[model samples]
Target: MSDNSGFFERVYEVCRKIPEGKVTSYGAIAKYLGAARSARMVGWAMNSSHNLEDVPAHRVVNRNGVLTGKHHFGGTNAMQQLLEEEGVQVKKLQILDFEKHFWDPMKELPQEI
Candidate 1:
């Protein structure tokens, strides 16, 4: 499972654009990258993104609006706390207002160069 540099960069770029209190899914990013089944690859890139200062990885969740990255967070319940601080409500690993907070780059983003 070699992590290519460009692929990771693409993941970070997309992940960085997710607004605070809003969320996106790995499958969406993979599709945006033109690899529809590469959602796991997107997750791999995110797991390796330890040095990104501005990329709020916590803002991303599973397709079902579940906070699936809780184990990866440092402090106990940190991912939920971060999301809540950004005005996203979470209840037992699920986002409260999912429809309003979900962000789909394919719809909201400008065309790529």
Candidate 2:
């Protein structure tokens, strides 16, 4: 496996912790994993996670809560569709009431980062 594969698994682990109806950002996950500058790595992880069954990759968005990764989900709106199914509203590819639905792993997870 490539070095990225390990980090990708770590990203997926953090993703699995995101609750239903809640959303987090690539930056948030990276920061939580103690790699604050690795937000793009988290995005890469999400892009490669489509085939996984329980990662809930839809729950992740850009820091501003935009569905920037929507294109990776097979359909133009599949990411938004999944979020909507989880009770999150999206508008113009951005999540509505973003802060209200935001899930910060740094805050939600029990361990210190």
Candidate 3:
């Protein structure tokens, strides 16, 4: 009912579509949701998504491919560990070959119905 909850659902919907071994930026998700300036809100949604196993919160990183949300995943390296498990390279808290791994929701998803 609340606007944030609705937005969080939208965020999760996009997250579910993020394929393994790939990642997206918070800003990208916000842009795809028609809220270009709501990247921080997208980060908030990722932080709140731990309980939802299907959300793939680890696949959402900052624009520069930094693991900015790592702290929220319990361990300091939890986020990095998860991404690494999926074969995404993380070094010094940043994703290597970032662009190669980046998934743009606006491009990956079909036109909105």
Candidate 4:
């Protein structure tokens, strides 16, 4: 695959590894993919990844735990509901007490995958 395609695949692979109800930022994803400043690129790829079979796009959000991708979700307010159902409290589009629930995959992820 070309570099762009490979990068997207890598993004999807990492995104797929995120557990349900958990969220990670585009910046973090980019960092994990060795593209520390390409968070916007990651978001672009995600926005265009409608057919990806493995990426749970809903489980990814902004660095502040904001549901910035809610517009792309399948149902109205589905992203928030999904996170809440997963035990995350959300208010005004903010993940309540984000420091408590944010999953730093960079630190928590295994060295080898």
Give a tens-digit lDDT track for model 4, residues 2-110: 7878788778878888877677889988887778899998887788677876677877789988888888877489878878888888999888887777766688677
The residue-by-residue lDDT of candidate 2 on 1-113, one tens digit each, is 58899889989988998999999999999998889999999999999998999899999999999998998988678889889999999999999999899999988997632
Model 2, residue 57: distance off in Å is 0.5
Per-residue error for 59 in candidate 1, Å, reads: 0.9
Scored by TM-score, the top model is 3
- The models' CA-based lDDT, in order, is 0.84, 0.91, 0.93, 0.81
**On residues 2-108, what C-alpha lDDT tens digit does candidate 1 reach at each position?**
45678878888989999887999888888888878988888878777767778888887889999887777874898999999999999999999898999998997
Give the Cα-based TM-score of candidate 2 against the true structure. Answer: 0.94
Candidate 1 residue pairs that clash: none
TM-score, predicted candidate 1 vs. hidden true structure: 0.91
Looking at model 2, the pairs that clash are: none
The TM-score of predicted model 3 comes to 0.95
Candidate number with the higher TM-score (1 or 3):
3
Candidate 3 per-residue C-alpha lDDT over 1-113 given as tens digits, one digit per residue, 9 for 90 to 100: 49999999999999999999999999999999999999999999999999998899999999999999998988778889889999999999999999999999889898541
Per-candidate RMSD, Å: 1.7, 1.4, 1.2, 2.1
Q: Which stretches of candidate 3 lie over 4 Å from their true place?
A: none
**lDDT: worst 10-residue window of model 4:** 104-113
